[model samples]
Target: MQLRQMTDPNLILFDVEAESKEQVIKQLVSKLAKEDYLESEQPFLEAVLQREEVSPTGMERGLAIPHGKSTAVKKAAFAVARLKTPLEDWESIDPTNKVQLVFLIAIPTNEGGSTHLEVLSTLSTNLMRDGYMEGLMATNSKEEFLSRLDIEEKVKSNSDKKYDKTVVAITACATGIAHTYMAAEALEKAGHELGVNVLVEKQGANGIEDELTPSVIEKADAVIFATDIAPKQKERFAGKSYVQTRVAEPLRQAKEMIQKALSNPDGVVEENDSEEASQSSSSSNGSGGFLKDAVQAVMTGISYMIPVIVAAGLMMGIAKLGAMPFGLVNELHEAKYATHSNELFVILHHLDKFGVLIFKFMYPIFAAFVAYSLADRVGLVAGFIGGAFAGGLHHTFWGIEGIPSGFLGALILGLAAGYISRFLNQKIQLSKNFQAMKPMFLIPAISVLSTFFLNFYVIDPVFGGLNVVLRNWIESAQGTGDVVLASIIASATAFDLGGPINKAAGAIAIGLAADQVYPLTARVLAIVIPPIGLGLATVIDKYVVGRRVFEADLRVAGNTALLLGFIAISEGAIPFMLRNPLITIPINIIGAIVGASTAVLLGAVQWLPLPAFWGWPLVDNLWAYLLGLVVGASFIAFANIFIRFAMIKKRELAA
Candidate 1:
């Protein structure tokens, strides 16, 4: 179908209002339904939303293209919307850009194979042209909009002129829409300005375009791969000096990157080795060494683990709340409560048990996902098996009884399993006939067996000892006094906010709480203080400090931070901290330390893991806890103000 034929007047909306990506998709779907383009709107809407979630369609320059193919659509069609305001947190490839123009594509399931591709290709190509986008945006009526799409030929640039230095670059992103093209454009412009000939191959949602041939690579002095993810067929650039960076870097500093590439054109080449040796080297040093890879793997696990932790923690808190009034708080975990005459008590008791069961899987999930991040599905099974073994699964190796190894052991097992699986994946190759079984059976079966033996013999013993030392140290700190222990935990929790260090401290606190050590109170304080402190700083900067230190975007974020802080989400402070990390991060850590120390000194105790404001009543010294929070937040606010003023004065002096 032609562009105009699919884009009817009824399917085009002007100045549409939507607060979120989902809402925008729904609105566009509703418009398509009004034109009788869909057999069912809800299914089509869901399909579109699912597609958007897989990788946001939001591109640079205030544009978004959300499309789906489903049986719910009776005909292939297009729905367009010009948003009155931009959609924030829409996962644009360029984070700085908010989506203002949306194109929604709906295709019949049967028609998607080729018809859909053709239409999408046409639209995507037209969208990339500046004159076409400008003309479309300037259109006042549906007819005018349709007429703008009638361009016979795409725009061409005369800057294709030859230059002395030739370079080839690839620009890609996870979403492969906005940042890919934006980086390509930026590099091209920068190359022209610097009298360098640059040809950029864009790997975008529409697929690879302007592919770099072997001749081009041979002719180019150097190459650049600006991507968030590793580009497909990366070995193609082997032996060529290449500069790697996040896609957005080129958009901001293309000239500097080009200069660096020119100066040092010889990049590190992958070594030729036996498959086994290659895998070993890759696991140890290929991706910036084992330490960096381990950190990244652990962070990936934590990102997935947080949701489960939050859900289970909330359920356990609610269960405690229900049992507290009946004087059954301690009995909530007892088996006798399962048969209690009071139905509510029994239900709460079961919920508490269920929460505990889920909590038990926390380490296993963390370990499994870490391996999965490194070695995909095969590593998942291996990691889970290793983690389970570490989590007190009975095992007899060389007649030595193994004990529960805990979180630290799980961390080691995860890394070991990931490397083992990655090695097997790279080194092993089956006959073509059995290739399918390799992924489904051979890889998983071998990886699991190998990881299990390694963990049982090597990783478990080493990390298990380390885990014991860690636990003993924590116990010793607790015995010395609450202040020291609380300070340490608080510092770790605030140091990286929701990052690896923060999650490690939080995980330890959860483990300690399971043993009835009562460090959750300090953890709860650490969780709330950073976000609240940052939010309070923004308010103080606006009203009390007698100036608006924060920009409009930051002022908006302050409100979100306050809301999230009340619910004990420390990650809400990340955006604010990123702006002035040197100032903001130190103040946040200090605030957390002060708050945690004061809470512990005042004997604040929490029986529930809930971080909500309503959980205040669960604390032993509620007023003291509140006082600690206020004092810590006050310090953060004043420190932020002072830092901002100092920065401003420095800028003035420099000027």
Candidate 2:
């Protein structure tokens, strides 16, 4: 009913003395075990470690909220520990702050989802004000600390009464500690102001712990799910009032979703049905949808793209490996693994060509599926029309001395198909028999016709004109590099996990792959380097710059994703940025731009159009890729060091 109702004072440790954040965390967790707050220290600690491996929880204002929702928690509990000395956590770039303040919140996923938002909102808002952290640090007794918390809670609770409608929400960042908690607080504050009963369920690396349980779901008017990672167990809210969004948006948009849901309490929008439709379409076509749809589409797309990218990337790699001896053409006859110019070699070459052919198969499929996710059956036809038209446009524009507008064309087509399908779905009607036929006849026919004409007359010509402008711009861009451009692009890439900026870059690479003109390996390497570099930098600088709480997260992020990065995967870096954007993005951007600029300047040409793989050398200049790697890696490492030092300095000033 109230914050203290859930918090056990026995679990709270004030003026807790520990040398570092990790030692303090372990001490606090072990203490929780002693107090019977957790079933055992090991499971709870392991969850903390495991989750942190994926994401660090070091938040703004020299605080570390390391939490987990796992089997380890015997009861929902909160503990506070004030370190005698700051601890080194992996994700903490500001070395000065080390984690002096640590809050270890434990909850069982099954009991209720962890109320991470409540804890974070309670803590973050208190920590944010000028003297609140100093007040916290100055407190010498549990009574003093409790008093501070009580005061903060009173103010927050009063704010909660302002909302006219009450809403419960679940907020999760991949790691579950900092951002999950912060977003939770944000939503709560908004709910309070709007007079809503806001509850948040949190899922973090620690596993699912104390949260708004099934009862909460059953009682609440609606639920808001803000997460970047896949939720562990989602069956509880099957038909409940709910909506999903990224973790950060809730502070601003969640209140609105709650308002809408409350206004029409019985009219909650469930994405599951639409998600399934798009996934089915993805299996047949390529991929499509908003976050859920896109995720499914991407999964399907990757499944389809893998064979082609592998065969092509490897063959091209082999060819590059043998480039000198074969003198390009003659080497086709030389056989190392298999006889070249022999049936085996010819067959392999044919497979390589087939792989390239399959690579082409992905574009239309991807475009169509994307449309399908947005507009269902009608979207597919429109998407196909758009993709096919884009292909033709590429040939006409770039191949005809007009410069490539393939990326622009594909985007337009996908959007066009989605809108067309949406329009038909809204305006078109049919009888029962016609409804069945509608998908086959009405949706496809009109969609295709609309897509074709739209692409032919409007999309093509618009991009055609834009291509001329873009080409001139690119030409002028030579020797005109600016730091602002680099910063803006890099920051945008790091701002959201797999959001628009990520897609834009990915779309460009995909366009290059489709053209068969530019090399795929080069583009993928550039894409892959950012996450890898930042991850490594987090690892390398962990000891000096991060708190122990963050080290757990960095270990997960740095280690779990490193292998994936070697073969050119970008998703691996998502957790790092998801938890701490302000700190993570700058470091990631520095790494990405360093890699991209270096690769571009070195003329690191890719012979094959494929995703990243290490067994084969896909690029014409392997060293250039390595150069990008080094530049990216070094930039982040240095950034971590410098940033951490600045944090240390700031803390000293405050102290």
Collision pairs in model 1: 241-267
Cα RMSD of predicted structure 1: 9.8
lDDT scores of the candidates, listed in order = 0.70, 0.56
- Report the C-alpha lDDT of model 1 over 36-81, residue by residue, as the tens digit: 8888889998888767534446666777778999999988888899
Residue range 456-480, candidate 2, lDDT tens digits:
5787667556544533443343344
The reply for model 2, stretches above 4 Å from the true place, is 1-14, 17-20, 26-50, 58-80, 84-416, 427-655
TM-score for each predicted model, relative to the true structure: 0.53, 0.45
On lDDT, the leading prediction is 1
Alpha-carbon lDDT of model 1: 0.70
Model 2 global lDDT (CA atoms, 0 to 1):
0.56
